[model samples]
Target chain A: MPYGYIASMKARPGHRDEVIDILTGGADGLRTAGCHLYVVAAATTDDVTIWVSEVWESKQHHDDSLKLPEARAAIAQAMPLLTGEFFTQETEVRGGLTGQP
Target chain B: MPYGYIASMKARPGHRDEVIDILTGGADGLRTAGCHLYVVAAATTDDVTIWVSEVWESKQHHDDSLKLPEARAAIAQAMPLLTGEFFTQETEVRGGLTGQP
Candidate 1:
């Protein structure tokens, strides 16, 4: 199964929409660069923060995407709007044996 | 193997330590309620965001902790200091299958 990487980030006050726009633009950037899936959800009560749940075919695919030109440049554009920091983990999927699949 | 629940919270400015304190207090409360482990890490770069990585012996253990009176009460005290949303996930450990164990 493909591994998953979840990254959660919060935007600076008044900059959430711009951040989302930039993230939206990265859809294609992510796909072409090797991302298998990427989903972003704004907090129901707090719009400034967004949780990005992403997946790649494998750890190698994820690492490869980070070095992609578009991914790096897009990250540069989005990093400043963040007020705090982000948490990310490289997780192995046990979804199959768990019977969820 | 145990399951893990990762919760990432961003505290309001100046409230990070307070939040961590609340969480720390939950350590005993969690273990008694069936948690196997609970660890909190303050972001190295952002003082306001903290990532809490927790493990329960099983899914039932995690669910039971939520209903613990201490757990509920502690959340009430800590919720207000949060400036944005939190991301929580219940995940199975595929470490064994992934050759990490």
Candidate 2:
């Protein structure tokens, strides 16, 4: 089964857009590192929170991607803009439309 | 921008699979109703909790889907199997790979 997770983070008071930019900037590298899905989203009703929904080929693939140079750099840049509040739910990809058909 | 959300629900003890089945079974109808993505997943460390990550063409599309007969039926069937615990975060789909062009 594929590995997946939905993670949410809060950006510093006025830096949500900057944080989102950095988070989304590493997608190409993530795809090459075995990510099947990497979606960055922001709550419609909340300005400081951002949600990332990801599907990786495996848990190991996800872990390895975090070690990639670009990934680490992006994370470092975004971390300063974030509030340190986070939420994550690790999941086993069951099944449904992923637009992969 | 696309409309999306990550919703988590807790199934009644031992009824998680049944709920997942019903939730995933409505995919065909949802696609036709303008859903871009609908992924059913279960937390690896929590057997009774199920997470559904979805992206629709628009918020209207998502709202319309819930009124579909098939969707209503599936919800009705799954509700009894659920514990009524739910978490929902509505989002504005920013961007990334969704396995779509």
Candidate 3:
């Protein structure tokens, strides 16, 4: 079973693109560690809001990903641009197109 | 290009499973209108939190799906169980496994 993570983040005014870029740049590296899906999207309704949906092979896989060098670096780079107002949801991915093999 | 929507919802007290059920029930109907993915996930960290990730062929495809009877019915059913603390992000889904042709 895959683990699903959905996080909502808000960037400081004018830093949305920067946050997205950092997220996008780190996405490929995440795939090396059983990250099945990592989709980052900018909100159409709110300029500073962004959403990230991820599917990892398992909970451990997701937990281990944060320890990766690229992941850590991306987080450090994205920290300043983030407003720190975020909510995270972790889910047991039942099934979906993104979770498919 | 496809439209991506990520929404975070909190269930009212203990209504998490019910909300997920309503969302899951509505997933198939959405596909009729070019909806590429509709993933309903239950948060692993928070029992009352649910996440929904959607991909549609286009923005119009997403909007039009809302006008469908099934979509409307699902929304109505799920509304009562929700805490109304949800945040939504609309994205221009550039590309992803789920959004693939």
- Judged by DockQ, which candidate is best? 2
Clashes of 2: 0
Chain A TM-scores for all candidates read 0.83, 0.95, 0.93
- The candidate, 1 or 3, that scores higher on DockQ is 3
**lDDT of each residue in A1-101, candidate 1, tens digit only:** 55666676789999877777777676755665556555454544466776555555677888888787877887899899997678666554322111111
**Model 2's lDDT to the true fold?**
0.87
How big a share of the true inter-chain contacts is recovered in candidate 3?
0.44
Q: Give a tens-digit lDDT track for model 3, residues A2-94.
A: 788888799999999888888887565666688777777777887898888888889899999899888899899999899999977788876
Candidate 1: give the clashing pairs.
none
Model 2: per-residue lDDT, tens digit, A1-101?
99998899999888998888888877766777888888899988878999999999999999998888888888888888888999988999888888744
In model 1, what is the error at residue A58, expressed in angstroms? Answer: 28
Q: For candidate 2, what is the DockQ?
A: 0.75
Residue lDDT tens for model 3, B40-84: 788777788877888778888888888998878889998998889
Residue A59 in candidate 3 has what lDDT?
86
Where does the lowest 10-residue lDDT sum fall in candidate 2 chain B?
B92-101
Candidate 1: deviation at residue A1, Å?
A: 36
- Candidate 1, residues B1-101, lDDT tens digits: the string is 56666677889999988887887775755655666445555654566877665556788888877787888988899999998788676554322111111
Query: Which consecutive 10 residues in model 2 chain A have the weakest lDDT in total?
Result: A24-33
Chain A superposition TM-score, candidate 1: 0.83
DockQ values per model? 0.04, 0.75, 0.41
Clashing pairs in 2: none
